[model samples]
Target: MLLRLPTSVSEARECLAEGAVPIGGATLLWAEWQRDGFPALAMSLRGVPQANALGPGTLGAAVVLHRIDDRVPDVLRLAAAGVGTGAVRRTATVGGNLVGSTLRCLLPAALALEARAAVLGPDGVQETDLAEVTAKRPLLLDLRWRDPVASAYIKLPADPGGRPPVTVAVALHADTPGHRRLRVAVRDGYEVVEGAAPCDDNIENALRTLRGTALGDLPETAWDAVDAQVGAVLRAAGDG
Candidate 1:
């Protein structure tokens, strides 16, 4: 396998244009390699200064999950911490989670946070909504979002070292004093519901539609937990 280390965004773009697969932490790529063999060309984003940067309102695409903690928003931190084992978390990245095939904890968190992404493509770099970038699966540079007034995340029951079947993330942004806008994002749905807080019926309906399965498949206890968690987050955000 040939690896290209780019020190700047321009170099990274050039490598990408040459058909080098962009790699961040490369945890997911490693899995793909195990099944499908290694690609001929790959570009490591780690060497790029911009891709490693993290700040109050921005998260570099190459930033590892373990690096996301108290410094970031609550919902994001919670989601990142739940991703995988300590070692995996240390190697998995924000960009990989956003575009990987499997469901990742950070996806919902980012959606609820209303994050925007900077992407580098054949044309050039452009700033666009995170949702758009995810859908298009472009080469990501970083993510940016305004700090929320409050945020929360929750996941349903799962084995000690296993991922949950469902997860939810909520963020409250203050539009004006005493008026907070609520945003909720679900794991499988990849859709964000904004404006008013969702009721139990709304939650149930969303789950049913998003999972593409009958609600009866989930136990009553699971529904209760989801309801409770959503309410708790809303209350914590002072929206309930």
Candidate 2:
């Protein structure tokens, strides 16, 4: 097998034109190709090119989360830096984590950070808001975020109860010096709800419906835990 290591997306594209499946970090994709040591033609992103800031007010795609966590004073950075332990955090690209969906814990925070997904697909390089990107069907390249915002993610580990555990992500911003802003994602079931973060009224309505109609659908223990965790995380984020 020939392995082509590229430093930039363009270089990777050129290698792809030569028939190579791109592997970023290969943290997750490597398992699928482990027996054969990757496909016959594979390009490994051994080292990324010099990462430059993109968009208005200094945002960047290539900046690793470690740098971001140290620089940004928000809960989302804390959540990003804490995802999947140290080894996974070191190897998993923010881009990969974003595309991996709500399971890995970045999607909720991305929604909170006000991050954006930058794509270089068949249609060419384009950027979309992170919240929008998470809900769409597309190939994702990288995630971008603005400076200085607060965000947080909360989830319950899988249990033997046969129910998908609870997961929530909350983010807040200061539009003016003191005007507060918020966004939240609640993945209660197969559907993910995106709207104003900390929608207490909506939560009340949902809870009413959940109690009135969806009670038997979910185990009482699981539902109670999910509700509590979501409330705790939201409270913490609001204080943050």
Candidate 3:
């Protein structure tokens, strides 16, 4: 199998039409290729429509991360930073993250924020809820957001090994007073354990896990212990 590394959107479209698999950052996909030897044409979308444009807070195709960084909530930017490391962040597309099913942290934050997905398929451009696309369809392109809102992504470590978290959660909150809403999602790797839009139940459940007996062994309570550590970091960042 061959790999087509395109530097622009037109080339990406051409490769897709040629039945090639779109690859962003080539981090997660390459890892899988090395481990499993899954042979498929690999296509790279680096520097095509621009790097930061596919972030979770934009409504249009032009709504990249660089453009919406000032407006999106702080937690989301933190999740983006956590997407692999510095090198991956520079090359990975938000579109690729959602498609790769890498983890729930970043996508859930976008979902909590009421983000949408913008896809340019064989049929042309189409739009739908970003979370829905991730949950259901084989997404093609970028992720987007509808209304003005606040979003947060959380990851909780398991045990004292200091490993990457086992459970990841995200929340999106509406800005309006009477119309306020929250969405929370909990996942391990690419598998979703729980998700609630207008997240009263999940948040209550999360807080409960910390306060009460562990429920269903989902790490809801363990996260509370981790929250303190995460909070200190946030506080330090704020102080800085």
Candidate 4:
């Protein structure tokens, strides 16, 4: 096994170009190694300044989950704080969570917030929608988004001792004098509902579609919980 710790973004890219797998925190990779063994070459992004940078509306890819404090929006903060456990939070990076094969809480939250990602790829760094970055599984450099009027997140576990199968995030933004824009992102889908207020029927229908198409066949009880949380978030945002 070989490890290369790059101190700058360019250095990191060089290492990556040599076929070294990028590593930050290594929380997910650790699990993979435990099951499937290690990669031949790995580059640590923790030492890269650009990957560790964090500011209002901008989160460097290497920023650990625990570092996502009050500096970010409540929805994002809550979602980060809720990932895995305290130890996992300390070791999981924003980039890892966003690009992980499995659904992580942060993805839905980021999508709901309309966050964009700065990706470092073969062509160089480009800013694109977070969804696109997730699908393409590129090297995420940072994430940026505009401040939202309000946001919320919820996750329901598949079982008492299992990962959550249903995760939802909602962001509310002021659009017109008497209306608001609602962005709802589920574990595997996203929907936008614009009106004077969030319509229950429309949101429910969207969730149903998501459950059927992307999220698999979730039980009605799970949908009920999602409905309850969505309502609570809307109320907190002064819409309900």
- Give a tens-digit lDDT track for model 3, residues 134-216: 66645355555554344445665455434446544344344555443444444554455433333223434444443342223
Q: lDDT per model, in order? A: 0.74, 0.55, 0.52, 0.73
TM-score of each: 0.81, 0.65, 0.64, 0.79
Report lDDT (Cα) of residue 70, candidate 4. 80
Candidate 1 per-residue lDDT over residues 1-240, each given as its tens digit: 899999999899899988998877888788779799988999989988778878788888889999987878888999999887899999999888887745656877887788888988888889998768767899888888999877888876666645455776777677667555556666633332332342333444444443343333445554464456556766775546
lDDT of 4 by residue, 115-215 (tens): 88888877778889875886789888888888777777776656765544567677766655655566666663232221123433365654455455433
Candidate 1: segments with Cα more than 4 A from true spot: 159-164, 188-227, 234-240
The TM-score that candidate 3 achieves is: 0.64
Highest lDDT model number: 1
lDDT score for candidate 1 against the true structure: 0.74
Name the weakest run of 10 consecutive residues (lDDT summed) in model 2.
Answer: 50-59
Tens-place lDDT per residue, model 2, 105-170, is 556566556666666555455878765565663445556666434455666676654555556665
Candidate 2 positional error at 65, Å: 6.0
Ranking the candidates on lDDT from highest down gives: 1, 4, 2, 3
- RMSD (Cα, Å) for all candidates, in order, is 4.8, 5.5, 6.2, 4.5
> In model 3, which runs have C-alpha deviations exceeding 4 angstroms?
1-11, 34-41, 50-56, 59-71, 102-104, 135-139, 147-149, 159-172, 175-177, 188-190, 193-218, 222-240
lDDT of 3: 0.52
